[model samples]
Target: MAKFYELQRAMRAMRQSALQRGALAILDLGSTKISCLILRFDGLDPSLASDQVGSLAGQSSFRVVGSAITQSRGIEFGEISSMQEAERAIRTVLQSAQKMANLRVDHLIACFSGGGPRSYGLNGNVKIENQIVQDEDIARVLSSCDCPDIGDGREILHAQPVNFALDHRSGLVDPRGQIGNKLDVDLHMLTVRAKTIRDLAHCVKRCDLELAGVASAAYVSGRSTLVEDEQELGAVCIDFGGGSTSYSIFLKRHMIFAGSIMLGGNHVTRDISLGLRVPISVAEKIKTKNGGLIVTGLDDRDLIEVGGETGDWEHDRRTVTRSELIGIMRPRLEEILEDIRTQLEIAGFYELKSQKFVLTGGTCQTPGLDTLASRILGQQVRIGRPLRIHRLPQAYSGSTCSALVGLALFAADPQDEWWDFELPSAGYSSRTVRKAVRWLRENW
Candidate 1:
């Protein structure tokens, strides 16, 4: 925990340095495509902003200087399967983006979707040392949180203090500067396999780029796509990616849980390929051009060419009705929705006051996803895309690039995390070190 605390603090410093330098790279490592966004932070806006996060005017805070997206290789379920291949893919996109931006970027923030993410709820309570809460009190309360055993080889990726309560009043976003007898805090800790993080960091380092910050794909996309009412009351954001589907639960504008499913859009493509006896590429094309979960009376008349490479003229020229395509895809899509429903059930999502569900990600645009999802998951389901950002290309303003867009916003102005505060470690609390620093300053 101490080592990770220091590592997080160091990354915070690196993020500040990146912002100061004005160019920060944002990377979204997806299974189907690897996307990169370069943001230029020129100057602050005059709009009134929250003290915790400097600016609320999202669009004006940062401009997209450069962007690139390329086919992903050696990546599956959002984790790097082949180090060299993933690194090569990363390098390819970075070179292209830097060329477009006409500027070199050293500091980067990245997001990924794999590594078996798990969430835990932590609680801590402490009596106020002074009449009002301060930085040390915040740090002390966070440090006092007793975390459960997250299993071996897993490390905490996001440990955010989701809610703070003063005495009996709950839902306090910031307890500092407030008078309180006792401070109670609720933390949302997201953990992933340590090897996943280490491999990602190594891959970034190999690319000659610094990984200033890392985020969970599920969590960041939720922040970007879920609206204020949905997030504030309660909502489930399911991001359908290429190789996996990531889901996060948000309440009171904070994520309480996040997880990933092994199956995603690529699975649907594979099913189409097998069902239609077409190549994977052809199947993907067909799926994108015509796949849907709904079957209408006219679907039987709608025909799609299932092209093949086999020399047999009849076999190569086979055609299938839209009804047949939907039949082949509906089962798999239902399976995914059923799995998501079961996961939400396990997370106790049904107990929340609001059951809003927002679906985003590239695959989330599958023709009849919302209609089918509403039937399988719940009645309150809507397809979502990332919010518009400053200087973002119109081409990138779709559900397909939800994670990339979210990563850009995250890189621009991030919300506060536990690591943002200086903790009560020996380096922070040791009197001898403080005295030595003071004495050196006085002597000099």
Candidate 2:
């Protein structure tokens, strides 16, 4: 636990340094596409005023100085499968973005969709030392949380104090400087496969770029797609990516749960390729051009040319009705939705105050997906796109870029995590805590 917090503190320090330098890169390492966005900050302190940092962290001021999107290679299900190929792809995108910006970036904050993320809710309380909450009190309460044994081969990705309480008064966003005898907190800790993170970090290091921070694509997608009210009340944001569909639940403007299914749009494309005996590339094109969940009488009469590169002329000229295409696509989509429904049930989503579901990401572009999701995942479903950022191109301001855009907003004004507090030297016994304190002192 101490090591995890130390790592988070180091990342936070790196992020602050990047902000002070006025330039940072946001990378979305997905299964199908790797996106890079070079943001040029105005060197303005986000803490200039509360009102300025209240919503979207003054995102309107930061501009995307450079951007690039390229096909991902040697990655599957959001994990790097081949270091050499993934490194080459990262270099390709970074070079393109740097060229556009006419400036090179050495620090990057990256988000990825895969990692076998698991969320845990923890509660902690500590008596106020001086009858008023202070930074030390906050840190004590946070440190009081008894982290569950998440087992080996996993590491903490996000440890956030979502709620605070002072004596009988609960639902406090921040209890500091308040008169209270006791401080309480509800924390959400997200853990992911250790190997997945190590590989990504190694890949970034090999590219000669410092990894300032890393985030789960699912959580960032919710940050970009879910509106303020939806996040405050309650909502689920499902990011349908190429090789995975990740969903996160938010309540009171904090993520409470996050999970991902390995199946996604790539499965649909592969289904089409295998079922129709077409090349993977052709199947992808067909899926993009003609994919839909709804079929009508007119679709039966509408024939789509499924051209093939096979030597046989007759085989190359075959056609299939839109209805047949829908038949091949619907089952796989339904299966994915059903799996998401099951996960939602496990998360107790129905009990939330507002059960709104927002669908976003590359695959959610399918026609009638909102309606289909409403039926399969229940009502109150809607398609979502990333919130508009300063000078973001129309081409990149879609659902597919939600994670990348959110990473920018997050980089500007991150949530108050455990490391944001000052821990008492005597409270922690681990040698790791001493190292963390020293690191924090040096970084700050």
- Which pairs of residues have clashing backbones in candidate 1? none
Candidate 2 residue runs with Cα over 4 Å from true position: 44-56, 427-444
TM-score of each: 0.92, 0.93
379 Cα displacement, candidate 2 (Å): 0.9
Best by lDDT: 2
Q: Per-residue alpha-carbon lDDT of model 2 for 1-444, expressed as tens digits?
A: 445556767778888888788888899999999999999988443554355564446575578999999999989998888999999999899999999999879899898889888999998888987887888888788888888999799988888889998997999997889998978899998989989889888989988888888999999999999999999999999999999999999999899999999999999999999989999999999999998889999999989999987789999999999899999999998999999999999989988769999999999999888888999998899989999887788889989899889888888777855577766776667778889999999999
Candidate 2 least-lDDT 10 residues: 43-52
What residue pairs clash in candidate 2, if any at all? none
Candidate 1 lDDT, tens digit per residue, 350-388?
999899999999888888899999999989999998988
| C-alpha lDDT of all candidate models, in order | 0.87, 0.88
**Cα RMSDs, all models:** 4.8, 5.0
Lowest summed lDDT across 10 adjacent residues in model 1 is found at 45-54
Cα displacement (angstroms), candidate 2, residue 358, comes to 0.8
**210 Cα displacement, candidate 1 (Å):** 0.5
In candidate 1, position 190 carries an lDDT of 92
